[model samples]
Target chain A: MNIPMSEPITYLEAIRHAQTDCLHTDERVFIYGEDVEDPLGGAFKATKGLSTRYPERVLNAPISEDAIAGMAVGAALDGMRPIIEFQFADFAILAFNQLANHAGAGAWRHGQPCPLVARLPVGGTPGGGPFHSQMVENWLTTPPGLISVAPATVSDAYHMLKQAVRCDDPVMFYEHKALYFHQRASLSNAPEYPLGRAVVRRQGQDISLVSYSAMVWDALSAAEQLARDYQIEAEVIDLRCLKPLDMNTLYDSLEHTGRLLVCTEAWPYAGVSAEVIAQVSSQAFHLLDAPPRRLNAKDVPVPFHPHLWNAYRPNTADIVQAALDLVRF
Target chain B: MQKIPILLPRLGEAVAEATVQTWLCQSGDTVAKDQDLLEVETEKSIIAIPAPAAGVLLDIDKPAGSRCQVNEVLAWLHSNESDVVQPVDSGSPHAAPTPTETSPTHTPTASLASNSGRHGFLSPRLRALMQEQGLTELDLHLLRGSGQHGRIKADDLTQLLEHLQSHYEPHPAGMLRQAVADSMSRSWNRPLATVSSAVKMDALLAHRKTLPERPSASVYALSTLAQALKEDGRIAKLLLGDQLWQAQQIDLALAIDVDNGIYNPVIQSVDAYSLGELAVEVKRLIAQAHERQLPSNGHNTGIATVSNYGSLGITWATPLPPPGHSCLLGLGAVRRQPDWHPATQSWQCIRACEITLTFDHRIADGGTAARLIHRIVHLLEHPDLLS
Candidate 1:
């Protein structure tokens, strides 16, 4: 039911195409969530027209959020791979108990595999109110027996989704709403990467900027600014997965630059940035020349006003300031 | 106006005290902020202490040539506000300023190496002079800068170079040549002693004449030296790490010229072959070396080496044995001179060559090395003994 095209697609379209391929490859694979069926194609259209080809597979679930998760776990336990799409990542809070307590811990507790992939449209949009804008990877990753991944590119979105459905345990796939339509990546014979590995988006020698999600682009822009104005070469790393945490690549880059700057869109304390710095300081202590630095969103609720939101979250300028501080220190 | 105390800054982590090489400003002189106030000489480098602020030099606590400890007040300056106040040690308030007791009074050229910590601010010409004189921070601390804003210029470094040439005996080698110095220093780690003897080469010369293919004297000497090394097991052992490896067969490494660079190529198992075979092998190796086709494999495993410095037209010389070799035989050019025939009590002509053997004292004493040299001389003096 999906139309074919020759040109490359946006990251959102890649996610849609990956789901279509998964639905076609396995008879046990099906998509059941709110607005995922035909005429609606799910929110953000990530599952756009898949219901037309596999009508029985893409079923529209009721508005009960708890039942959606409970049923997905039940279907996976009965030998079916179900892809659940929440209308917004913030709405997942309504079903957190069922997703975390049962779907996440079911396999370990009862020996029943929970082969469920819950795709959440995470992160903020321009002028999106507090109800719609939320990044939940840092929270979802804390639960045991759950694989949390945030894909920063089109190829990653396409491949990581196919891998998530194939995995036996539960997976929380966080797709940034801000990058869904704005970001585009070439998918022509893209190299394969593992789930928990990080990628160096740019190579340098002076300082390292480790970030994930949409903040990866901001870190790269800051690295370019540092090169042009300050003559400081900054290396940028994109941590695609949150749970497994690729400390090897981080240490390798830290050994070369001797300074680390971790950036995230979440709050500063007890976030992913805090964990990264803590691990680096404990393990690669001698490799550091100065204290490791980090930049994160202000510790407050997601702002509703446009200017307040810009001030609350981290940007290229914030990343550049943190990089300068680390390099000069 | 608040007076700020100027303390001697620690140039490096290991530096405890530094000598005030020269004072750029005198007491009562008005100095600008960031201006070079004085130069201090530490063991690692020479650093120029800049003025903490625009101020007048109120008093001099430690004058030029005085050695001062870290955080010891060098001077006091009257400024609008005290921008930097590094407190001095309390126990040393009345401590007398000790003048540098180590070296003699400073000369002009030795003082030109001083520079502020601003590394890349030097002009290309000044940097070139620094590189040419091989001056360091410690050397520059002695100079009072004549350039603008305490910048050491080319002319200052040149004058320092001339002054250093007359005063200091050894010049600092640059980074490129430091490897050679390091290896030679490591070579000196072993206690070495040398012994010399004059050997008559009549039988060796006679043997060379008998062969249609005349072989060089080096091959004959190498063959006899290898035979002697094989007979003495103690001399054939090599110190490899903490353990001594006893060589199964003698490998003679000959220092030869390859593409204008001196290369020592090893002829494997030299003692296992006869003198005639060694002559052929030596000729082949030398020819291959000249063609730049000989490999340097197993060159470091040699127990002994023969250095033919005589080929360069020297009559007598002492050569430091290179590292990794237990002994080195320095052979001088053969000279034909008049000798006293003891039986006839008359003067006669004979060909004699000077040979000096240097060995590591750790493996053998002077007397033991002397016996080895004597054994080699006896073999070369009587060529029939080689068989």
Candidate 2:
């Protein structure tokens, strides 16, 4: 399904377009989740127009994440492509056993193709309590054989989602709620980027700023500030996919910048940032001028109050300061 | 007569001691205010201490070649008594001498090492410079720092780097050069094929005359090539590791010679830029490249690469595109040559240049590459097509 190139689309609209494209292209591809079929269109309405287009393919599953995930796995095993949507990424915990044990491990254990895509509405929205907001790429990626991708731009949202459905392995797709209506891109300018490939959002020489999901915008902002204020050009890389992490892009960037600063909204210890830094330090030690650094959310649980939440997460200032320190190191 | 103590000043951060390299004035020597009293050496640099007030050198408390701690009394003076120039006892009870002070005692001091650990640490920028200069910690330990508590600041490292750079041959593979090498290596692994076409620049030269700022032929070629790519999708394919990528935005990469190495920084969204805008952006990128401070990271992701060998006064040359790119364009020198003009029915003087297109054979066939070059030459000969 080709979109009219003249119009621009928001990140949410891109998700809808991606689903529509998948449903139209593949007869086996179907969307299953609670309240996803009609007027409700699920939480956040990413599937708002998707159900209207294909009533048979866009489904409304039981309200239980475990049962929904188990059903998706069974359907996928039966040679049907299933896309399971979780209202909020935080609810993925309810189906962790099914997702990690079966969907992720089935391909490894029985040589079966688990062509399933789990759409997770992730990241904190204003006033979104702890139970409603979470970045769960790390958790889903912990299991073997599962691909976790967090798209930063509308173009990536459209491109990567389509690729996720075509993937032979199960994919955990996290869409940032904050970027739902915030980011916009021209449909005409959508590049054909493949899944598991990282893109350099902004280029700089002095430092490499690596991030994924919503935090990519923050990294780009920090890089701009660094260039304007300190004359430090920072390179920003968006790790679109997490599980099959693009180490090549990160290494190539580190080898050029000679310094690396990994930024994430997730907590610092043993998280995505830590894992990236560890690999870069080990693989590109000779290329590094200083120890790699990371900017992450505060270790405390995410608070509900707006002010507390603002302080709890890593913002532009935090990333800029971390990059400045890393470059000066 | 009142005597004033001349103490060793705190040179820098964490510096507890320095060796007296020379005594500018000796006992009984009358020195004016703010005059050189002694010269001392630290781990980073050599510093010369001056007299705080005009006075007669009463005694040399810690003589030359002695290790004196910061604030240790190095000498004594009769305050404001330049006329009474009499030598006093050099060995006063207030004098504290460390073992390394005399006889060039080569004993390694653990204090300096411990001080370096906690207080006088090197910044990352300084450390990077040190690594660039091929300087080790031992070399750092040999120079005296001027920073607080004897810490090595970025400026100090810069000076050391300059000194080392002047004394030895500069490293051939600097950071930027290494980046170029890596990019070239990636490009070299690809199966490259080249196609060339000759274009008459009679219209292009006339078009440049009408513009407010007369842009170079390379700039004109860049604009025309970007237009051609935007119009045709068959030429805008990037192949990497079994994945074929289609270009959403047309970006152009220009290779600039920076005296030392070639720097190819991409000008993004070039298809949307007009001739004037392209000229300014190209000029800015060229300036940045020459300054050796171009912001080059993953920004090298251009749809096609362009090498203006003509600008460097070269004829035809084949240039390879960096990996993940499908095509590259080379512009040779435009020169006045005699050619048969069918419209004039006679030999006429016309400007002509050779345009070479090196493309990845894996993505596009020879026919596609030939068509792309043909489009570019057509756009150049008929400049109205671009406007």
Candidate 3:
């Protein structure tokens, strides 16, 4: 199947295309999640019209997230690839025991590969409130033996999801809801870069702005503003995979620019941004000219009002200010 | 009113006690925040202690001329608010305290203490770069940092190196030049002083003419200084920490100018050799130094060094001693001067030159240095004693 290179595709279309390709290539692959069947499709319309194409594989599950994740783990162990989708990332917390204890440690303890992918819609929209908008990638990534990935670009969104389906281990795929219809990119025949490798979205020298998911866009915009206003060139790195963190890419960028600033939309306490800083400070201590810092969302529940949510989440302006302070430092 | 103590901040790493120089504001005067309350003199410089907060100068605990240690309260200020009297610029030694509030919009202050290069708060990357390039903190004193509070950042060092590379062509110093530089830099750590006096060289010139083979003026001065050191070895004592180590032999080194740099070749026991033997030895060493063939371990154990800078047409010089040595004796160019003979009521031309002795002041005082230089001048004037 060839995706048209002439027209741009949204991040949501990239995920659907990836799932369609997986179902077409492999007969044993199936997707099981709440409201994923025909007509209604998934919660974000990611699986729209998929049930008509592959009716046997595209099936809906009961509304229990725990039962849905547990069934996927059992099916993966029984020699079938299964993909589970949570309507929102916040609901994935209900399946924590099944994902972390059963599927996460399946291969290590039982010596059998658990080829399952849990697609979680993460990050905020204008009125996502507390339940539908939380970024649960940090909690999913903390458990060992699980590969967690948050793709920011349309190409990575298409390529990395296909890679995750093929991977022998279980993978948690975090798709940013806010970027579904907002970001668009034309498909290319570029070879898929291996997972666990970070790409430099922009080349710079003054500081390294490391981020992933929706925060990568904010970091890129902040880099542009820094270059235009302060003459500070900020290198932006997109960490497509979070579990097997590509520290080498971060270290390489830090070698040129001794300052580092990590941005994430999650809360600060023990979040992905904090983990990045802790690892960089320990392993790449000598590469740092200034102390490595992180910019995270305010330590509060996702606000309901649009203006409150705007201030609660880390945005382009927050990233710009953090980068400037790091550059000056 | 809340009484806030104005403590003396740490001036520098080694400074302990400081003398209160003058009080800028009296006890009853009301001072604003950051206003100079008093000036204190440390060994490094005079620093003014500022009011930590806007208040009245309630009392002067340590008045002018009273010495105080670090963290000691020099005075007390009566502030209006008790809860908000935060110590501003508290850790920085020289910066005056200014009232600053922590606002939500302001950038959070970095947790690392801000320090200048001299304070030695070096980052790991900066330290690694310095180690790779064979540089110490003292060697990079001139590099100004753009980091917080004027701390030297790693980029500043790399930028300095890059600026040097683009602006100038670098030629790696030869081993001999590097050795000399290392020795001179180590010797410069001590407090060194030079004393000079003029010696009439007419007798020495006349005496050398009587001998079968004439010795160079440097060899004569080397021999004279060796004899004076042998008479009082205290003048050549090497100060190691608080103890002085006296030499067992009166060995001296002769500074010979080579192709790119100077070599100081040691002549063991100069008092043991006669004038003719010493002249031949000095000639051999000079030839070997010019050819860069001096034995590696043969030059560094001398107790003192004698430099004949007069050979370069220099009239007088205060040359530094080599590392591990305590003193250096330098001989200047000889000049023919008109002298009046009062006993015969006549004027005559005489040959005279200046002799300078540079000594490490940690081992000897000015009187000791002056006496040693006077003895050298005496021996040079009476050349028969040198033989």
Candidate 4:
């Protein structure tokens, strides 16, 4: 629990490590979902070496989410681990009927959790328009059945996926395709992310910017700029989970900063942003300097316009402005 | 149609009340006691009473079937034409009074368990009772459970143990009575005592008519009341009781009156359960009770207790502290019409259920009981707490 965060590594290496380590630790775990074979581990390059190392365990399945998730549910019922992968994050939505409705809530309601994991390649910077580029966390996080985790860094992608693979509950492993090559964190510096705990990527004193997935890097970068430009030490919290949120850490940051700005890829209304603002306001209203703020996409679905879309999600510049406005106010 | 005054039968060995089996005398009919007027079953025996003063029976105060302690009248008797006689406590061919439950005074501890403190809580007799009913030491909090402080006797846990035994279908009075002996022994160790009162259930039943359930419907008062208990403090922990060993979020029990004894079946996990869930469980428990397929227990590390006695206008009833539990609740029948509280001078019209909170003198005082009762009352009034 007290591991350090210093070294930098790529999201790809983290996920591979998570796969191999989990497969090594638990014999019950085996790979499935798509082209998880000897030569190509997956289109996202996450399962690259998994097939070679775990040839017997790595399996390729027909492109049917129902069969895949249902088969995994059966495996878990028999007390086995079934890690599934979808070629594209958006394509994984086809399984939502099973994942969210049936698989997610079946256990807690009936006293036996569905122990499965679906690793989806999520996020847009790879120039994937509505078809391929989509942050699935926005849609999959709040549902009842599975716990959704979208790791932005390599070490997280590695260890958290391992934990999820071993967890008694099913998990939605959403690794950002944008951060796969991210080397900001070294393997040595990787701190284990427990199931439900918000990590403070950058410690600040004046304002708090809460985000998850790839936005952690941007928020941290903005925190650095905000500190030097206006001395507003923005505490950047990387929310690893979209559900069963670690509200305590987030609340503490808001209490200290007295101002809140939530940054995410989803739309503001009825999204994660709404949930955060409501929880913080209800529990820590006395500490607010102004009402909590969130920078998110418009109501329209993620568009194909690269230039116009650049304005849709928050970036380093937008984050800096958010901090600046709070500082000036 | 008939008003019968339920009375406690005279048991040979310090036994008190008797659960009514069936009415031997019909609502409108001539009757003779020696002719099996009605069955009065207790921890002692299932005996019948002779007609007090043979005449055309006018009214039956205590119906044939109820849980009434000894010495209380079973029915009213009147001579034919001119003689007008009041129901006499004595000089009537009725069952005798059980000093244990009906006595105006407390009995000596020696009369309950022995002076031996050694297997105080785990004597062969006590173990037999517990094993028979499926209870454990963890079942009792503190208080060796002996009537005397630091002693564990069968009598301390007798009433509660008997209460648990009554959960079984067609529960044997001998089993209930023996369990009662053990539970009372344990209950007495702690200064915990029970206070029971009856309330009119009409208002609650009427309100129930207002909120219709979606499908598999259930209705319970204790679930709402537990929310009231929570207003006192953040819940410490939730324990489960039953075959599945599901955690009981709400610590409430429905007290059912059977022929040989009284049983209190616990409604599990009211704390985490929604009102709908509570209703469902209450319905299940009641069905089990009616079919005589009831379990032999109400196990939960409960903070409070509730006994529903409003069914037959037994508005006020005494509650026996369940073993290891701190408080017991006795709720009375809802009146067909509301009562005017002369002190408040308010015509409180909406439906109301009577509740009595019996608390451990060792753990909670009357003041604390009042606070708890206030919270429970608040929750019952605002059943939205279930939401």
Candidate 5:
């Protein structure tokens, strides 16, 4: 069902466009998840127009991540591309079982791929307390077999989501709520996103700051802020695909900067942050002047209040500060 | 004055054309002779071309990023004064009107070798092959080109150069090379001689097996050997300069050759690594050596070297004294053999190994080396110190 040649879209509009456009492009591509229908159209507005355009293709399922993941896997196995949305980022925990154990490893170990996209809404804003505001791109990228992607722009959401669906491997496609309304790039059409790839949002050399999900925008903000305040240039790498990470971009950037600072909302230990640091150090050890530093969530759970949450998570200021420390080191 | 068309200088031999990357010096900039005026790149490397004369740049003939040749005019310069450096009648490769011997002008006497030198029409296939591997002038000269006029076409050099540079070439010298060069020369020049000793290593083996493995446990026969060698006052002071000078530290490099050039990884402080540690260290070093896992570890220099060829079934072979450290005690393969001693009065099968000491002749005479080897043998024979 091709999108009715329609008007230009806002961030929300582009999201709706992403689902419908995808449904039109690949016959194998379909949408699923709880409340993903004409009446509700997903917890977020992403599937608003998709269910109407492709009735048979767009599906509604019970609130079970495992069942959702299993169905997508089965669909992919029988030759259909399926995309399922979690109501919120924290809801992804329900599906982590199938994703981490089965969907994530099947393509790599068994050589039988499970092509699926798990769209998740994440990031804290508009008083989204602990449960709804959680950013779990970090949790998803920990497994080396699967890819976790976060797009900060509507174009990215549209193009990357479609690209994620068509991929032969599973992708935890994260949509940052803060960026779903704010981010704008010099993009005409949504880009043809490449899975397991990284893109540099800004070109720089003094320090390399890698971030994803909501923090990606925060890193870019920190880059601009640092550029203005202390004249320290920061290359903000939007780590689009977390696993099968485009390590080459990080290495190439680190080769010039010789310093790395990763910004994420994940906890510090044995988390996504650790993998990024390890990968950078191993692949680019000779290039690095010091070990990579991270401005991740503290070794605690996300807080409830605004002030507590702000202190718990890394913000633009935290990213900028970490970037400054990297160059100094 | 003379009118000379200055051609572009060739960068690395791989360059076909250069996009004048940057002009460092501006027109009218007073540049001393040999001062770089511009940086140019030909895909691979960026090189800054130095000014040929001390003068004020008069004109920039080539624009930045323009593609040009090795004899093309880059810029013109005016020196302070002109003199008869060369006779006016000695017509050289220049366009001159005044016929002054030297008018502060750079005139070319030999025309730039153009597409004329190796003008064989390379086949499309050969050209592609040459373009892929990024060969250079030195490479072209090395290749036995079957193309026209013996010019190396793409295909002629591709398969062979790839095989030579990547597959057939020796892996490069690591940090160990410096130590080896230093030690070997020092030992070779020194007035050195060896003292061979046949000792039973059964006690050492038995002690090693008996120890309840612990990290803090004492180092086995090796430490005993080191301590006994220390008894000789001169043995510890200096090793063959060949072993010492070339490498950085006094770190001992034990030769555990695994048939690869860059495989050797020194056990940081062999004396400090105890018997359990020694076994672990040796095993780790050997595994890394064999699997090529010990990477970039040999930055520190080795003071002396020991080749325990005997442990690995090779017996009684002379070892090269590494460049930094002078003396190496080569041990023969330890195996069960019948040994006869005057005290025993009868032949008995025992575990025995022979040690051959190769020392620098220039630094130490035969007596010192003999004394050193004897001390080492004493420690090796008595495993109590190691235990």
Candidate 6:
């Protein structure tokens, strides 16, 4: 069913709709996580009415994240699609062995695809401390067989979630908690580009600003300010899929603007931002007029206080300063 | 009293940091605004940091020999006047005083010179473009780069090519003109000086009229210059670093004005030939230069050059010597001027012209140049000696 165009759909609603659509069409699909059953829904109310509508498919699990992931992997291997939800991205580490070793490498080792979707509530919020807010894409992406995607727009949140449910390989869907309510867009039924491709959120000429998830919004804002204040036009790219990075799109944008600045909400060390910069520096060195630079969240745990959290993550001002440095360089 | 920060202003585009060499004033010293507070040495030059406002220097944050980045606070000042301190924005780190607002006195040092004539860094894209266009470092040096530290960025190169594409129609300079331009640009790097003296050519003109084969004034001047160099061959030496290379022959090049360009084909051993033979050789060289048939072998290497710009009706001109040469002799147009003979007590019109000698000043000084011109003028005045 098409949602009414009169009201804009938020990132969280689009994700709920995508799961509902999957459950209605595909009988083999089911969602399993902590407190996800009826009356309680999920922690963030993402599966509010889903348990009541499809009681057999939506089941509640104990607080054992490892057991929850292990059961999903077993169900996926037995020709069933299982969607697992981690209360917060920081708690996903307890299931790292099952997600990375078993489900991720199952297709290559046993010639059987583990069609599992892990809905991770990632990124920072006002008071989500170190244990609640964390971007786990960098950890999940390092494994060989996982497909990690962070959707920034409501359209991608609606479409990519369904695409991940259909894919034979296991997918790590990192949905930014901050963008859940704040970001909204008109739900479009138009055909979507396949997963693992980047989208240019804004077109520019002076510099290329590459980011993903919630940082994509900040990059767009920074690009606007750069054009308005410094007369620097910054091209913004949202890397929808972090694992299968669309380097060709980056190369094309970098060819137009010889400068590049990447921003990420994750910490700086061995993360998505680092990977993007390293790839461009090695493969597309000739296209760069200035040294490629990246701005990441401060190398610290997600802060507890609101003011500290504001300073912990990379913001629009930081992005603008980084873009200015690259453009002026 | 309030404390104010004295920031290190930006030195240049390419200079990122500088070393605090010496402090002109100690702590507790009352300094005036714009007074030199300290000296810092950057990669480009030595610059003096000035006091932002008149105040007592509280203390130095960065001591001597310590390096600091641009806009870093060097020291603090305690001032009674609160208005003297400009309020800094705490919200934005980039909202600091610009270079113009904190005008530091820049004094360029001889230690770190500019890289105008020298080849600096070339970006990979710029290198590829240069290779594609068949351009060398000399051609690259001709372009003024707007990049950091005066580096020629690929954008600068492309912009220049685009400008040329839109603004001007390009015509290929053929082999002859290209060779001349290349050599002249190389020769222009030398410290060249020119000296000119008036010469009465009436005797030389009359002597030429008496001969069966009359030589042109350029031929006569060339012969005289060659003879004078033969007398003092030390003046024709080339200064190569700490040593001087002596010439093997007194060969001279005759500047021939061809269509669209000039050619200086060497006429070998001018002093060894008589006036008639020298005149014949000069005519043949001029014809060969006009037809662009001058030999490419070492026949172009000469000790000096003679340019007869007077043939084009120029009264006076200083012609430059070509590469591999030490000096150039230029002949000016002949003009009649009244001369007074004290014994006769009357003025009589006489034929006269100015002869200029342009030489590499590094090889010889002005006294030697003056003496050489004097010798050539003496020979030209006594036409019998030239014959």
**Which candidate wins on DockQ?**
3
Using lDDT, give the best candidate's number.
Answer: 3
Worst 10 residues of 5 chain B by lDDT: B84-93
Off by over 4 Å in 1: A1-6, B1-50, B53-387
For model 5, residues A1-329, the per-residue Cα lDDT tens digits are 44433444555556677777777778998888988997888887778866777899888999887798888878876778888888887988988878888888877767888888888888777467768887786678777567777776666766787777777888788787777667644336546667667888898967889887678778888889888876777898987777767889898897667678888877777766788888776666556543467878877766777788888888898787566544432
Error of 1 at A178 (Å): 0.8
Candidate closer to the true structure by lDDT (higher is better), 1 or 2:
2
lDDT (10s digit) by residue, model 3, range B153-183: 7877887899989998988888889888888
Instruction: Give the C-alpha miss distance for residue B199 in model 2, angstroms.
Output: 90
The regions of model 4 sitting more than 4 angstroms off are: A1-8, B1-387
TM (B chain), model 1: 0.55
lDDT of 2 by residue, A224-246 (tens): 98888777789999999887889
Best-fitting candidate, measured by TM-score? 3
Question: Which window of ten consecutive residues has the lowest lDDT sum in model 3 chain A?
Answer: A320-329
- Lowest lDDT 10-residue stretch of candidate 4 chain B: B85-94
For every prediction, compared with the true complex, DockQ reads 0.02, 0.02, 0.22, 0.00, 0.01, 0.19
Query: Which residue pairs in model 1 clash with each other?
Result: B45-B137, B45-B138, B46-B137, B46-B138, B109-B160, B111-B142, B111-B143, B113-B140, B114-B140
Model 6 scores a TM of 0.75
lDDT (tens digit, per residue) of candidate 4 on B108-171: 3222222232333243334545676676675654323422222343444565656657874554
- lDDT tens digits, residue span A1-329, model 6: 55554578899998999999999999999999998987988998899899998999999999999999999999999999999998898899999999999999999999999999999999888898989888888899999899999999888998999999999999999999999999888875544878989989899988899999999999999999988876778999999999889999999998888788889999889988889988988898777776678888899888999899989988898887667655533
Ranking by lDDT: 3, 6, 2, 1, 5, 4
Q: Report lDDT (CA) for all predictions.
A: 0.77, 0.80, 0.84, 0.65, 0.66, 0.83
Name the candidate, 2 or 5, with the larger lDDT value.
Answer: 2
Worst 10 residues of 1 chain B by lDDT: B89-98
> What interface Cα RMSD is found for model 6?
8.3
Question: Which scores higher on TM-score, 1 or 2?
Answer: 2
